[model samples]
Target chain A: MAAASAERRGPRDTIAVSVRDVGMVFGDVHAVRNASFDLPKGRFLTILGPSGSGKTTLLRMIAGFDAPTSGEIYINDRPVSAVPPHRRAIGMVFQKLALFPHMTAAENVAFPLKMRRHDARAIPEKVERYLELVRLGGYGGRRINELSGGQQQRVAIARALVFEPDLLLLDEPLAALDRKLREEMQLEFRRIQKELGVTTINVTHDQREALVVSDEVIVMEGGLIQQKAEPVQAYRTPANAFVANFIGVTNFIEGVVAARDGASVSVSAHGCTLPGVAVGEALAGGDACAGAVRAEQIRIAPRAETLGNLDTLVEGTVVDAIFEGERIVYEVRVPGLGDQLFRVFDHDPVNHLQFSPGDSVCLGWNARDMHVFKK
Target chain B: MRRSRAAYPWTWRVMDGLESLAARLWPARFEKGLPYLMLAPAVLLVGILVLGLVQIGDSSLRVLDTSTFLMSEDLTLANYQRALTESFFATVAGRSLLGSVIVTIVTLIFAFPYAYLMVRTPSSALRKFLLVALFLPFFIGQVVRAYGWLIILGNQGMVNEALGLVGVPPMRLLYNYPAVLFGLVQYMLPFAVLMLAPALTAIPAELESAASSLGANWLRTFRHVVLPLARPGLVGAGLVVVTLSLTDFAIPAILGGGSQDFIANAIYDQFFRTSDQGMGATLSLMLVAVGSLLVGLVFMLFGAGTLAMTGGRK
Candidate 1:
């Protein structure tokens, strides 16, 4: 709430993009509902959502690829709803990288400049500078297919940024790469974005990428913007149940609100009441709700007595245990919590005694970590 | 697993048995030679063609004795010399060359948008309609289509009848150079579209979007990106249309009214009407040389991939 208020009060001159009640309808299907947001200049914003979540549709609307069925979009305080994509000064790195296979690396990078009719004498120099920016300086003579996958990505980035567009849009450019290379490119994208200070919007389904590269994150679902906040704020305090569940690995405990006190609510599930923070809307006694707890927030132990500092504790049997190098995931069915399977992440795997399938265990979490939302 | 195998359908069992029998008969050691063995029929057919071409070459070097109505015993260059220097043959060759080139250019201009629309249309029904319209002429065969055009474009035919309805008099729309070229274009339209559709489909649609997003308008996008990328298709379609039009016999024979004789019609005239086998063979060899030269030129300019010979790799 504070961050949103700060965004509204950031002054008109600083806002690089402002979308007002933008809606995109395709026949009978509304691909994007009324979405409104303000992105401050030089801030990297990532719209994160799973496939078919309308995140790409929203980005396409902002890039002028698809006109909004309602309202308008302002880029640097200019209404650009009627402008065609070519007329808008926006660079986009498509999902497939869409590098012109016919052009050499330097030629591809010089494409935008040539199209925009930049001074012919300066195209080569600008192309070289952008290639160097993407660490492909001497590779200007190489064709697109001649480069490796990562090198092709660099060529695409150079091509997009060489023209110095007002906005840079990345449409899951790293989605096709291997994990190690994707992580490297993610950092590279952030460094270059920060260096260029271009107001950018990247659409991706990668939550870690959204958190790693963006100054702000917008989580969308079912053609609607569910939450728009800083990455940490979105992770720490999601606006609703969907945002909480979508952004991270979370376990939901179904219950009815037993009592409410200020910002916290006690949810009665199985035979006991669990304390949790109420998010998004107010709740009262007898209201149906569910408390969402992050998997890492829960601690697992062999005995119940050892979880002394936890605000809530329950006994369970390990249904499955997965050893995932850095952390161990234990799926525990807690009988005290109606035999519902609860996932608990143990961060300290080397020091802790690992639990195996069918082993008796205890799960514990604090009230602050569990966010309760009305059903 | 044994019980499942026993429970398999009779067709599956038969297929399994046949496979094992074939493996035992042919064996894995001979697997490398199987592909070569499969190509035997095509090689044999081409070998026969090469032998016939050699026969034609041998005959082309001889001159026909018109008085005795027999080819001369001794080989000579008289036939080749006569075919090259004669004004009649020269006019026919020049007309065929000019006509084929024009047909190629005009056919490609017409086929490109048709193929592009067929490949890019979002509606399956529209694509199906375009495909059906393109292939419908192919089913009607070239000779039959030329006859059909003859019926429509004749002096008192449907086209002239319509013009007559406007009180413009039944003007001659057939038996001319334009009529022959128009017939060739109509005959080659399907071939051009079929050749170009796959090439257009191979290009990723995103490349066009990328071009537009990079500040190129629709026309610039086509010139800078789509046109260059679709070059292999254009070159290929052009080659097919030109070569086919150059070698065509039926369209000119039906529509030319004996005036607009293409090279094929001239060769037919030498062999049948004039009873000059040596001259016909000479013209046949010359046509092959011209076609080969044009194909060689295209390959030199745009590599073998222009015909998709080397996987169309850039």
Candidate 2:
């Protein structure tokens, strides 16, 4: 919490990593285009994007594996465009977890220290300390193949951290594990990052992982950053349509702006006027726009009177109702909205009325919950 | 719907009938031993070789009489005694062993970088060019290649002609120890490269990147990761080059002129030139023993299954 507040008080010198308008082009393809971000000290930032979206390319530039065609990256305010990877004070966990198969666990962990020319007597103790840090204590004598998949992950983490690098980079290291193990490791990564207070930059396509483990998330698409904000802010107030749809289950209703008053806008769609807050660029009257609403923000009731207190109401038939333990997700087909489908989550597990397929229900939400963006 | 016999192609019907006929002739009970049955010819060929080796061993124990030029009826250890005591045979055996070791070492030193570059190059054109150059000599026979080398390295040849342009005299570049060693190394290069390529390919390119990120330069990565992983292939290639060069006949016979005789040249001279079959048989058995001992030593140093293709745990 103290770190979070300190990051909120953003000062220039506290920034640990800054990518200044970095771009990379391979032949004719632009792998990354003018990407720039500043990571404060002791903060975890996740670069989240789908495949071929330049997330990995940006991480590679930061790690010095590949040079950017333009722009520069700085670690601790030092311009590192020309420094080789081995000379940089950065550690990386690869997607494949490339532990040396020829060496035992302890030897693999000890490699970086030996390469850095640490004191010979201090190397073994530091390796043991890191092995125990990753919870692989007393198992360092076994070869890599003798360990399980998760244990290999532990060894990779230990090896990357034992050298005490200035920054750590994770390139989707947990992307290959089973869900249970992946979630467990996500929390483990969070714990280790917090305990060590090392600035980290993780690249992943897993949205849930980005939200769970990162202090800030950078959502990217088409080799460009769409949004860079705190996880909840990025989820609640996305910068554009791409981020809204990528981060959560968002329903976008096409409409035209009918009226604008300061921050509020009324959009006319499917013979109804839907009120929403104008976001991003200002929208003029009659301009084509979309009203983005999250599934959990809307309420579902059996009848219109039950949803009387809400500012907006619409009638829909339940197309599908899925029971997901603590909540029920109902896919409602709203006929007034051009027969578009809208998903609604009812979290009242005890008092909620279950709606079956083809049952009529009313969905309601406040106008503030809808974000209006111009098409 | 069931199809009639006419609906099927004639080739398919013939194959089906042949398969059923083979099954009936072999019977289901004997199916389990089919692999061993198929191996009978190879096993028999090896058995014949072993039998010939035993006959040679028997002959190696006998002595030839100078008056009749025929072996003695009773077996004796006279030939073995002569082979062990004679300095001429000792010098030939030592030269062969030493030359083979040098050839093996030099061949591997040249082949490692060639094979590594061939496997690691991102350009397909360069890789294809290297591959063609390596296999070009293979299509030409070894004896023809050695004769070609003689033309290239002889006085007033291309090399000497180039040297003559610089006012240097034409040198004696053929029929020496270094010439024989150089020919053996050239001949064994393709074999060594072919053996090492697969092992180098088995290592992931990502491993090198990982090493670099983990604070290793290119040289350190090669020494720590690549050299260790490629040991099995090195040992396997070394065993082959050593044994083949140790008992090699053509390179030494063609390049040695008259002075530098290896074990194989001595054996050939004993059998054909001197008309001494007993001495030739003795040299042949000793060569086999020496080759086997060297192979055994390699297997002991490395493992017996060093060249296994599976990617399982070591």
Candidate 3:
């Protein structure tokens, strides 16, 4: 990966680019709304969303392509509402890899320096230095067309970083590549963003790409930030149904919060008085929310478990089962929620699980693992 | 226009005409040569035009005075030498050439961006408006347009009237090089825009956005990225503009007020007014030769630009 070969050298890492209340209105369309965040130096922040979810629009405001309709942006604590994109010292890698086709690799990297009116004498050395940083040292004299897709992407990175902009912006950088190439580039990008100690913001729809690279992930939907958290936290304890469904596969059971208490709660769900705790906020009965539980959280067996007394346990028939290479997924039939599935890792099927589509089994998990919401 | 596949029904009148014509015309043509007979009109036109140009060249080489149309057909250099030595004719050529080159350059500099913007701007309504607005001048005759400019720039017209209001004296503007240049640009802006529009439109929007996001904003992006990619369109626009302006007669004739007549007008004078058909033919052929040379230079310099603007000849 280019980033691995790059040498780590820069000032102490800190927050450099901060976006506060950033929103953009292109005519009647609100492309982005109320987007407030800060990007720290030497770290990567991946703003992830599907198309039209506003991640690209937010990145544009950072690059100064469009000013927020009502917001302020800051680069190193200085509010840069009035600064133009070229003057803002922000490096951006477009999805198309926007390398100047007419110029060779070295000249493409040298463009930003020329724009900044840097000494022409030092441009050649500066070009070599950044090209080396991206592990594309010898490829500098080549035309952009001569390079591979991965190599062209590296050249684009070399170009953006050559300017040594305070913040580097990547707009769906790996989106155009095939799945294997994308995964390969994802690691390379994370490494390069780290090695240069340049604060980077990546925008993508690929969840795995976001989880694998970003120190923090911000998921956006419908021009609003759905949630912001580290990958593990967002995965395990999503704040809302959208967040839960967006992060990873989760089983959702409609429930009502019958009671509330500190750190834990009891819920009446599936026509039964069940016990659960709020994953985000305490809720009461009749509130509109959902209870989400991971598939693997439910342990299914022919017999009951030790937590049978305190566990949210129910006896249900295995509606179906599918062997998914590493795990077995059993679509267990619950009385109220119909057929909600439970997954168990297939370490060895002989010792752990055995079930047919119609066999009755007890699905159960501890109350601590039961995430209840008012809906 | 009739659709290609549909055929007219076979009726009695058609059958009679077909039978009679085939009996008379098709009989001889089938037995002899129908293909050459069919190709005659177009071939004859081309033949006449080429032979006419050669005859003009031959006439231009012969000796001539008002007393006799030509003293000799010996192909002397006197007519060519006399044409070269005449300051009035030479000055007309120089001023016309220089003025047109400047006008075309300025027209392209201003029109190309507008053409590009008209095409790239997101709203289809706006693009349509721009397209229609660009071609609107086409419906108006150059003579009428030239007269309109004369009023606007004349001493007692809108331009002088505005200057008078600004506490400056009304100055002579009509019947000058500037007036002529302005008239020519107005006459040719639409053509320049038309030549450039398709080329500019053909350059994908992904190209410029790609550049801007790469740490290069509008100006740097335009200079390095958009302009280079649009180089072909620029060349095409230059060729069209230069060609039109170089041979422009009506605009210069009206606005130049006899001070800035070009080769077109000079050729017309030699052929019709001055009764020097040989000199007029020489001037006309010179215009074509210079135009061809300029076009050759355009093709050599900006290959893509020529291709984009003029559709590199098949």
Q: Where in model 3 is the C-alpha error above 4 Å?
A: A1-13, A25-31, A258-277, A286-288, A294-370, B1-78, B116-132, B161-170, B198-222, B308-314
Worst 10 residues of 1 chain B by lDDT: B303-312
Task: Please write out the lDDT profile of model 3 over residues B1-314, one tens digit for every residue.
Answer: 35442365648558877889877967864856777778899999999999988988887776657777654656676767776898987888798779879998899888977898898888999989987887777787889888888889888999899999989999998898888888888888898888777777666676676566555678777888878867777787888788889998898899988777888888888777877766776777778888888888877776646554355321
- Model 1 segments more than 4 A misplaced: A1-6, B1-29, B312-314
Model 2 lDDT per residue over A1-375, tens place = 122223355345488898888999999999999888888889999999999999999999999999999999999999999999999989889999989999999999998888788899999888999999999999999999999889999999988888999999999999999999999999999999999998999999999999999999999899998888899988888888888889878889999999999989999998999999998656899999999999999999989898888878999999999988788889999999999999998899686547899999899999998999999
Candidate DockQ scores, in order: 0.81, 0.66, 0.26
Model 2 TM-score, 2 decimals = 0.93
Q: Model 1 over residues B108-203: C-alpha lDDT tens digits?
A: 999999999999998999999998998898998888998899889888789989988889987889999999999999999999999899889989
Instruction: Return whichever of 1 and 2 wins on DockQ.
Output: 1
Cα-based lDDT at residue A245, candidate 3 = 71
Q: Sort the predicted structures by TM-score, highest score first.
A: 1, 2, 3
lDDT of 2 by residue, B176-260 (tens): 9999999999999999999999888878887787888889988899999999988888987888899889989888888877678
TM-score of structure candidate 1: 0.97
Query: Per-candidate RMSD vs. true structure?
Result: 2.0, 3.2, 7.8
How does each model score on TM-score?
A: 0.97, 0.93, 0.79
Q: Candidate 3: RMSD over Cα atoms?
A: 7.8
